[model samples]
Target: MNTTPAQLPHALVMIRPRSFGSNPQTIGSNTYQQTDEGLAEEEMNEQARKEYDDMVAALKKADITVLSFDDRTDPVCPDAIFPNNWFSTHPDGTLALYPMMAKNRRTERRQDIVDYLEAHYELKQVVNFAPFEKGSRFLEGTGSMVFDHTHGIAYACRSPRTQQEVFYKACETLGYKGILFEARDEGGRLIYHTNVMMWIGSNIAALCLEAIPEKQRNEVLTSLEASGREILLLTQKQVNSFAGNMLEVSDPEGSPHVVMSAAAWASLDSKQQELIKSQAHPLPLSLDHIEKYSGGSARCMMAGIHLPLKPGATP
Candidate 1:
């Protein structure tokens, strides 16, 4: 099995936050985000803007094409900065809209972004899963699951935010095999989103396997191993540091670079750092305020634009 054969997205969609903050609706499932009652609205938006700008600048420096869209504040989507939860694009030119658990987050399905992309790229079809939200069954896009595009595998941790029926439906549509498992935090609470616990790259899968149920551990390991992906196990502390939150993308020169947050990079020991470096150049974005408040890190902010480019064009 050939690992690391360019699973990177050609372009990245980052929704620059206008009103980023801790969302109360997500608190039940997302233990990572806490409502900071003392923080004022203006302060939240300002810090988020600074963090968003810095991350965008760093991604551009690495030669990764980044599209920064301003988030809407009128309807008020507090967690709008994490756009990966709302939609995902595919190389087949299919755009899939996910069913968000939060009512306000459901409002995040913005056609304007799609329209903007259509003006630039080639999109074949749109898959709407938003109707599932009507029945209260939700599956937040890339947040609820991580796709190993090359392997035809979708690894997802079971949570209220991710339902099996919805997962299976999506897998059927995307031609992916759904691998379901239960994962918990240190306090025995379910991990809100699979992306926060693990990430599947072209050649490697990084995750805190200990959090997964023991019964399902072998199955998960077997699946990745069968695909010849090098598994990088993370500790609970590292998971909290957002170590699992990473994405691989090619630079302007076509060199693969792995993007992560400063907090996540700091948690790596010497050996782990070298292993990652061997695969791709490390591009760490400073997003402390964004991570602390939004409960999501680098990977969550990046919505992979997998559509085809124009003739003689590059992302």
Candidate 2:
């Protein structure tokens, strides 16, 4: 049997947003969001599509499997390009669906995608956490919590989008240890997503330690050290540039590739770049329009597909 590494997935699921733009509903907590006054809505959508296509092509060219889906037009999900927030797959055949902070984003959890995955993969259990939204508790999949699958740890920052109780419940459900912390951006607003401030790869962990409170930094630092990962410290400015928002994927030959935005790559200094290069090949995509409108980068656009394939299923 062929198996993928726990920390790195060889396949990803991505959604191409047709009506892609900055989501007004998410603007309150997502300080990183900004609208492009220069481009009209149609132009913005066209640019986003182009960027999305280019990213998918690049990932596929690198020998990583990409399952692409088109976004629905009826409800008009502006932030649909970032599908990582809706659901996550596991090697244990557990498909976890999360409760979203934005009502519009909640609609991104389409039944067709779930059905397709179940047909192609070994989906043993479907753990739906969407019910928690009724109580006003939210946990937006990978956006709310970043999982260190190799160590069974889920690193999360507490915010309106990431509730404490719900995050622990997800950890318990996935059989992971929940390492909850508080992180704030430069303006002292709570970081919207854990993935926006930190990224944990197989052998490397990149994070903006300054975003985390002084008293709470040691736990995250100690945990990363204990996990045997080399830490690449990021500045708050870099985090704002989406430096912390990266995903480490593996090719068919099990070689690592760090997928990030051009802005994110430019934010890194020589030392940080070298450290990342030492661990994985840097694959930066230019997502200028998407980043400006959606406030998400390459990492947020991909949902890693970690489920084992069913009999005779192609990756």
Q: What is the lDDT of candidate 2?
A: 0.91
**lDDT tens readout by residue for model 1, 1-315:** 112244668679988888788888887788777676779989988988998898898888776789888988588898888889999987777889999998989888788998887777778888998899889899999999898887788999989999999999999998789999999999999998999989887777898999998999999989988988899999989999999889887655567888999999999999899989998889888988888877889999999877777565443
Candidate 1's displacement at residue 235, Å, is 0.8
Report, for every candidate in turn, its global Cα lDDT versus the true structure.
Answer: 0.86, 0.91
Error of 2 at 194 (Å): 0.6
- Candidate 2 residue-wise lDDT, 61-171, digit = tens: 888889999998788899888889999988789999999989988888889999999999999999999999999999999999999889889999999999999999999
Measured by lDDT, the strongest candidate is 2
The alpha-carbon deviation from the true structure for residue 161 of candidate 2, after best TM-score superposition, in angstroms, is 0.3
Clashing pairs in 1: none
Highest TM-score against the true fold, candidate:
2
Runs of candidate 2 with Cα error greater than 4 angstroms are: 1-3
